[model samples]
Target: MEISVKDLTKKYKDKYALDHVSFSILEPKIYGLLGRNGAGKTTFMEILAGHILATSGEITINNENPFDNQHLIESICLIKEGNNFKRDLSIKNVLCIYSMFYPTWDPDLAEELVKIYGLDKKAKVKTLSKGMESALGIIVGLSSKAPITIFDEPYIGLDAAARRRFYEILLEEYEKEKRIIIFSTHLIDEVSLLFEEILIIQDGRLILREEADVLRHSTCAVTGSIQQVEAFSKDKKVLNKKELAGMMTAFVYCRKEEAVAEGLKAEGIPVQELMIHLTENKGA
Candidate 1:
């Protein structure tokens, strides 16, 4: 599935949740939707999911508008952190309802996941713990087999082992059947390996969109003598730096080949570090 978003804007009063954001995703792969807390990730996902309307702009899925379109809606599945189902309903009832909506829904897979997650079929939605609720959401999302599936912080209240199991299952499922999966999480370092591409939104703008490998290699840390580090970093885009005594360490945004020629010790920048350096309190 392909998505084309142009000049997308969502506003409330005088504030813009998404400000003229424009980007096109043509390939189907796992995408990491990342940003600080109020950075419009949810707004962008909601627009694509047709949960809310954009203040201005256009969104087309496979060249057709997804807004309230039944055909496209069936092809999309979005699982948020909380309460996506009726609290009074049983787990079995919830699965039955979702099965009717998603054409590719796998009841068998859902049942299997319910057992694996240790969720009782007779338990009401409200009777389950927070982690159980998230697990149920995960089951629906995976079993839906939607062409475009989104998980917005879907593992809340889960223990470390449970979280790891979900990650493993997610990757295993993705490999078996490829689709456009948009995953948003604050656990960047842990899930960085799962992303084929990365999209970073800051404030209400798209600040960075690049392939995972390209982004990782685009920046490097150079640590050596102050004079040599400064000489190499000159006329280059330096994301961050530190100087102590006679030593200097700088994170410079440049190609690996160029960094090798600088006569300094250099290492590829970590994804977490790159994100921090790029988005950390820009005004401060």
Candidate 2:
């Protein structure tokens, strides 16, 4: 399964929500879409899911345009942040309605997920707690078995334990069935380990796309005297920097060899701190 976006653009009023974005997603890997609020991640996902039309350019899944194409649409499922269903319907009725839409819906899996999430099938959607609603969303997403599953902040109302369970179940299902999953979330560090690749959108632009391991390996932290840190960071992309008294610490993002060689000379820096450095720099 391959999803290709070519010169995709989405505009609202005079502002470009997604500016000529292009990327290809190919088979069986989990991708993490990371960005700050209003950074175009949602726009891109909506376009890919065929929920909205792009202002210009094209998006194709398996060489077929996703927009208004029922065949392609059935193979793709998107769980958005606030996917509101009929508030009066019971959870079971909601699942039943969704089951008719997806060709690959798994009834057993949905039942199991309901049990795992501690959701009451007979409970009305309006009466269920916020966390329960999110769990229902998660259950539907996982059981749908769509080739392209896109989750946009699906764990919004989930507590820490519920979120952890969602992650575990997601990975377990992924391993069992090799499917393409694209997830957009602000909780980068919490779910970074599940991503095979990371796609970062910054200010309505595609900033970086790379393998997750490579991304982690490429960034490092250098802490020392202010002068030493400054000298070491020269010509390097310093994602973030801080000073305490006369000492300074810098998070340098560069090629592995470059960061390691420079760090060795300055003093060996720990790799475990790379995510913190990169995330801090991303915010900055």
Best by TM-score, which number? 1
Which segments of model 1 are wrong by more than 4 Å?
256-261, 281-284
Q: lDDT values of the candidates?
A: 0.90, 0.83
Clashing residue pairs in candidate 1, if any? none
Residue 113 error, candidate 1, Å: 1.5
RMSD of 1: 1.7
lDDT of 2 by residue, 48-115 (tens): 89889999998899899899999999998899877557899999999999899999999999999998
Candidate 1, after superposition: displacement of residue 39 in Å?
A: 0.5
The global Cα lDDT (0 to 1) of model 1 is 0.90
- Expressed as tens digits, the lDDT of each residue in 1-284 for candidate 1 is 88999999999999989999999989889999998889999999988998889999988899988888999999999999998889999999999999999998988889888988999989999999999999999999999999999999998989989888888988988999999999998888888989999998888888889999888878889888999889989998888889999999999878767867867788998787777877884831
